[model samples]
Target: MKMDLGDQGLAGNAAAGGRPLAIEARGLIKRFDHFTAVDGVDLAVPEGAIYGILGPNGAGKTTTLRMLLGIIDPDAGLRRILGAERPHDVAHAIGYLPEERGLYPAMKAYEAIAFVGALRGLPLAEGRKRGKALLEEHGLGYAIDRQIRQLSKGMAQQVQILGTLVHEPRLVIFDEPFSGLDALNQGKLEKMIRGLAEKGTTVIFSTHVIAHAERLCDEVAIIAGGRVPFAGPVDLARDRIRPQVRLETRAEDGAWRTALPADARREGRFWNFTLPESGIEPLLRALIEGEAGILSLSIERAGLHDAFVAIAGEAAARALEEGETEERA
Candidate 1:
């Protein structure tokens, strides 16, 4: 649980780190009167990266996005959007999908998109054509002329997504973009999000849910109670995660106990190990080449779930200790 502040560059260090950041926030702090919503958070999203922010509800993900969009000013921090200092200056270049979705129920799908496009200064005629084209491309062409309220939940969500992209922004910020869709719709949306990234749009989004982020993001930063617990590439996070391996041997033998790694345990006939750095490979070779007939060996990499568990567990421990200190004082 020890924090490793490695040599990875911060989000806003443009002078030294010349790699253009798709999105950057440094020392971001948000306070509503006396209650701090977002603490000092440092987040860096690389260009064309589907960066994920994960935490439970009320974890300040929405608040942080609000600050970044200039909906709410941070108590203090630095933020840049596609290299601009102010959100309004680059607002047209940023497509936002807020966690709480709102669209005009009375407006037709194409009408809504055209309205948004016009607001961003795109021509009404072009917006109309592209909006209808987007509908057709996403298989929502049938609903293009229908009022928003006439469409199902999934259909409405698709319209919102289409509208967000109508301006062809450089960056797309989607807060819980997968929240309300069915499995099929979710798959479609996932493909759409990845497609946007493939087309070179930078995406940074927050989710209480982990699986979508795991499937979509190249890198992730986990925040809890408004502070980051871990931030790095997915592999790096996996490495930092508590290393646990699942191995099943043939003939259902419990002989694994004799040659097992130090921290290994037995469940039925399977041997599980929480590997330390030194003894993984040698231990695996010993298990495999020796009399322990290996049947099915599956090494379970610590996923975002494990990462979040590790993160939240540490945060709880820290909060407990700090509360105890206050009580003692």
Candidate 2:
């Protein structure tokens, strides 16, 4: 069956520059009894961009996503999806993959994929056709007729992802999409996300893994303890932390020692410290003039991990590190 194309107007509006924001939430708050889960979070996702919501476990990322999807209403906030104040009418234009995975064990892979598409306003026959094409394109052609229980965990995930995109939604939302996949599968998913953006689909996903956000997101919001401390381009977040300089020299006792920044720490013949606002040229000149034999010197630029540690605090950074360690184990 042919799918209704009513929601195509939303995508056209974006192409025509009617509204640049595909998703927006302002002052969103959620409370469970006396305890608040989400606190005054604001978000803006540009059309055709891959946006990431990054936070440690229990940082209210899922709650914020649910509210934005209209699966649950926020106690205080305004949210718009595809320019609609309420998402109900535009629900069919969006595709979502929840953190939790579910499927009938006995269902065939194709049927499962098609069923999800049907729910997204795709007709069963059309869903099946598209599902088959997606599976084959993703290298799962042999598994189409196989039962869900017969497939491996990674294969099952690909089927689910195909289901999410079968209806060709304009905006795709994935909550913790890479939680359980192995490294290879995770890499594949990353490529798939980029491909979606290339095709003009707005993508938003929540993750605790900073590496994914660092590699995939055009912009990210960092949330911790139910509040967002930073949100914007990845480069802006990295700017929150200072760059470090590492130096090793044969001559230790000289004007170079005095020229070192107050925060500098010496470890044997090496010195590690952040660059001063005055810059490194003066320090380099002092080292040379002081007869300090500079064996090697290198500057280390700040990364997303460093930015997270600075903006979210040591406690939240520690939590994220612990989570990654657990995932690896």
Candidate 3:
């Protein structure tokens, strides 16, 4: 559900009352000299929601996050985290994992996690205690004493994820958090992201990899050339892109589905076509006669991959504008 930004706090994220907004941004804009990296952006996330930010490279996502973290200031806009001014005042309530993750290579894994917790204002003793528990929970307890360098790449990635949550913040933002992991580790992290949101902590993460965001975020904002092309529930995002649907007639061998239209693109024994919202009635009739060889048929909605391509294509055009301007200059 969309959250109202009338109040902002962990509780403000709730759909109503002083409920938490998890995270909310309004009129968010940032620029570099003559260029705008992020145009006007607005986002609303309720408590216990997993929201994703999707955009092509140079879409101003990083800049937006940086401004929220107070690492940089936006030229215009407002950001609220757990109901407070972000970064400077709201730092304690937010956990952040940047796209470029790093840890002290020589530090012990446990120590690094604790150190992160401490930075978030947790006491050393408590941080260490919780840090160990987090590591163990993520299947990293054995690596507590190991140097960060000693851990494999995925292990180190897990440590970073653990550290991001050590302070128990009400909101967490992870950028490209799944970039380098293998399938197993990716699944593990996906579960963890869901678990975090389930516990009333709003989660927002960014990725160029649309599938990860598609499966994770309850709502997403796709930006291009610093502007929002689509924002809202993932379903809405897919709808906004409005790509073709694929109907796979799972038939085998030489015999084709007599009912299927001749226009479908064939893959192996299957033919694919988009089922229009109005109805697939006309097409269904065509498929009936061809139904003899039809083993099965399924309608698959346009996935996030298609959404990204559709949305990003517009962004690419806007970014290309800059090149044209520069050449003219």
User: Largest TM-score belongs to which candidate?
Assistant: 2
Model 1: what TM-score?
0.85
Q: Write the per-residue lDDT of candidate 2 for residues 1-329, one digit (tens) a residue.
A: 12122433223223223548898777788899999999988787889989999988889999999999889888877777898878888989999999888878898999999999998899999998988889889888999899999998878877888899999999999999998889998999999999999999999999999999999999999999889988888989997877899999988687668999999998877899998888889999999999899999998889999999999999999998887888778
In order of appearance, the predictions have TM-scores of 0.85, 0.88, 0.77
Q: Which of candidates 1 and 2 reaches a greater lDDT?
A: 2
**Clash pairs for candidate 2:** none
Ranking by lDDT: 2, 1, 3
Against the true structure, whose lDDT is highest? 2
Candidate 2 minimal-lDDT segment of 10 residues? 1-10
Model 1 whole-model lDDT (C-alpha atoms): 0.78
| Candidate 3 structure quality by residue, lDDT tens digits, 1-329 | 22233443233334544545666677777778899888877777778888888765677778877877788877877777666765678788778898888999999998889988888898888988888898888788899899999998878988988988999998898877876777788899899989888888888887666667878888888777788877777886576543343554544533334444455676665567555555666656655556644456576667765766676685564453453344235
TM match of model 3 to true structure: 0.77
Q: Candidate 1, residues 272-327: lDDT per residue as tens digits?
A: 87765674677667767666777776666788666666666766445534533443
lDDT of 1 at 88: 89
- Candidates sorted by TM-score, descending order? 2, 1, 3
